[model samples]
Target: MTKKQEYTGDYPEKTLYLPGPTEVREDVIEAMAEPMFGHRMDRMTDLYTTIVEDTKDFLDTDQEVIVLTASGTEFWEATTLNLVEDRMLVPTSGAFSERQANVAERLGKTVDRIEYDWGQAVKPDDIRDALEASDEGYDAVGMVMNETSTGVRNPVEEIGDLLGDYPDTYFVVDAISCLGGDYVDIEDHNIDCIFTSTQKAFAMPPGLAVCTVSDDAYEREVEKGDSSWYGGFRRTLDYYDRKGQTHSTPAIPIMLAYRKQMKHMLEEGHDARDERHREMAEYTRDWAREHFDLYPEGGYESQTVTCVENTRGIDVAETVETVSEEYDFVFSSGYGDIGEESFRIGHMGEHTVESVRELTDAIEDVAGL
Candidate 1:
């Protein structure tokens, strides 16, 4: 008789409390262990090809989604090279978005930046004003949906509406850290381009980057007269066109795992997943506010993760290490220069309310807060 592979809590697992690679469900992990299929085979095309199509339905878009064997950063180059000709009017509220502008500048494109104070959102009015003020009407405008740096969720829907009639400008979003937990109405919102990585909220291991491009953007890529082939939109488009295949042997396990993850996300329902994320965020934020200041403003906070200000003066690194070594629960120190004064805790993916409660309990016990 074959033994069933099941995991019990007799031995605690390494529960991730930081952002990016959150905790995936047991079923999803098993799904990833499926035998590898040939990338050149029809079976591969059928399985992953469906994932690409289903992802479009999930996003409520008629746009063609190009799955790349790269991170979301590649789309920065793809978007800039394809749609952008001259200058980019980029607005940033955190580190990641700032890097997008930097990518534009590095590519020799003139970049006009609209930067906001850290821990704040890029407001719709700011976008509207910037678009109106641009004498050249900007080649494109890009922003991040959820800034992982400070746990601030940007108001993307509002900003999208602000750029409604600007047919000449491309509205691109870096939706990496918020895809599964965050609900984005792509078509109704009139988003020109939406890019996301698989690791964060998709409940899959990293290696794939997804982008949904509008008909306008597709035409632009097609008309760009061969800017780039490798890691470019042309290669992705051609792979789908010629053989219904990916550019390379994909992270086969991750692709298979995504099938299960997507099924679970859909079976459990998008509304439920989104509500749970919001619930967890609210609970964590309420607790954090009572204990320390929120990194972002009170009204504007992230639903997938929370960045908490350290008011109790506990050594964050010491506390994190102590808790991790003691209980096997890992958390995040503040990023970049703010590592000492801040910390982050992710509450997305397969984690339940009970799980979050356990995480909170561990923090309270270890730090005596």
Candidate 2:
């Protein structure tokens, strides 16, 4: 068992069970080891085009796709700048959803929101009422499909149905944590723009943000001349249409990993991947109910991550630290105000039900509840 490679000093790695930056396959990591190439080269075009088409196929959407060398947060500003000409009606269900509304406000756009409790889902009727009540009308409605903070999967499809009456208001969704793992029919749901980061359900490394844009969203960007320079929908998608490459220097290595991982995703097929996530979610929820309660409202739990209420009166921070120290594993504490009252177990990406069991077992051993 002698080592072939010399060991390094102070190199400790914890198994990530967080909502994002999930476990990645070794081959995907090695994909980044390929020789570097010029961004404008033909090889780069092949790499970028393959990933883009593969992403569309994986998502089962005909909408144009944009891959940027940034986190999912980039699209928050991009969507606001490009589409929200007057007001954006955001539904605040959790931290990430609130952040989306804040991004619009910071960008100097008028933002209205339908507020909900931390773990409640957004109501479609409430959205309809908000739009109906807005005298100035709304340019876009922002929502988060999977609220990473509270583990609530808001009713995106239901709200999309309501938005059909208001075609002027574009539907923008943040599917960052559940896009690849969960099933969301973007076109059928009437989504104008949806965005996700690779590290989440894509099971890839960070540094790449993938988005899909409908034709209406593209027209809105064209009409709004002062859109974001770096993340402009037309500026990025048009460059790809003409040259099959990004408008700026892209994250070539990460995209290389994206190309490899996306192939595995296609091979597994979308329906099967989504079913696997559902299985993991059900297993985790059943386990949670055995010892604690779910933080999100019943029948609206996220299929990618589960937020468990600390009904056992355990010290959440201490429990997380002890699990990491003893099991070399890590998960998330409840977000924002609920940090001390709950903890999160992320079952997205390649996490199987058995993998979830390992962490839950360790948690039981550490907390002794």
The Cα error of candidate 1 at residue 22, in Å, is 1.0
Once fitted onto the true fold, the runs of candidate 2 whose alpha carbons sit more than 4 angstroms away are 1-9
Q: What is the lDDT of candidate 2?
A: 0.94
lDDT over C-alpha atoms for residue 62 of model 1: 87
RMSD of each: 5.5, 4.3
Off by over 4 Å in 1: 1-12
Cα-based lDDT at residue 317, candidate 2? 95
lDDT of 1 by residue, 211-307 (tens): 9888887787677665556556667777787877888777778888777787877777777888888888989998898888889866779988899
Best TM-score among the predictions, by candidate number: 2
Alpha-carbon lDDT, every model: 0.83, 0.94
What is candidate 2's CA lDDT for residue 201? 95
Q: How much lDDT does candidate 1 score?
A: 0.83
lDDT (Cα, tens digit) per residue for candidate 2, span 10-126: 766788899988999999999999888999999999999999999999999999999999999999999989998879999998999999999999999899989999999999989
